[model samples]
Target: MEKIHYRGFWRSLNQAWRGLHYVWKTEGHMQFHAFAGVLVLAGAWWFRLARWEWLLLFYAIGSVFLSEVLNTAVELVVDLVQPNFHPLAGMAKDVAAGAVLVTVIQAVIIGIGLFWLPMWRWIGG
Candidate 1:
């Protein structure tokens, strides 16, 4: 195999942005996650989360986003390789989806833990 010349850092960054744009445009789940992530960050600001709380919240958000992007990539690859209905391809897609679901659930748990008490107190008070 021939060695490929390295592109500049800016070109690599541009490619990454293109991938993110593709996901945002093509994946409804990604759109939903982006909206929800914005809301969560806004809530963290509104609630004035502590340093550690902010760290945890950001970590959870990043985890879910990363999972979603990877899942989308997996689905796209599976579709490309096996456009026809095949059991193994279906299983691969399902597993990728499941990974997204698990990450979303964990993020929800983290959000609830971070916000519930503060919200309750704010509402009650």
Candidate 2:
């Protein structure tokens, strides 16, 4: 195998952006996560979340996005390797999706803990 030369930072950044664009374009779940993330940010801003709360929220959001991207990558690789209907390939895809579900569940728990009270107060008071 030929060794590839190390690209500069900008090229690397562009490649990363391209991967994100590919996921955003091809994956419906990613679009949903992006929309939900936007709503979370809007609510966080509206509530003027504390610094620690912001940190936790950011961590949760990042974890969910990271899990989604990794899940997409896994599914793509599985499909590429096993184009036909293979039980193992299907299991691999399901596991990848399960990872995303787990991440979303955790993030939802965190979001509720962080925002539930503030949202209730903001609406009721």
TM-score for each model: 0.89, 0.88
* Residue-level lDDT tens digits of model 2 in 10-118: 7998999999999999998889888999899888998999989989988998899999999999989998999999999999999999999999999999999999999
What is the alpha-carbon lDDT of model 1 when measured against the actual structure?
Answer: 0.92
Kindly report which residue stretches of model 1 are placed more than 4 angstroms away from their true locations once superposed: 1-6
Cα lDDT computed for each candidate against the true fold:
0.92, 0.92
Error of 1 at 9 (Å): 2.5
Looking at model 1, residue 27 earns an lDDT score of: 92
Show model 2 residue runs off by greater than 4 Å: 1-6
lDDT tens digits by residue: candidate 1, 1-125:
97765677678989999998998899998888889999999999999999999999889988988998999899999999999999999999999999999999999999999999999999995
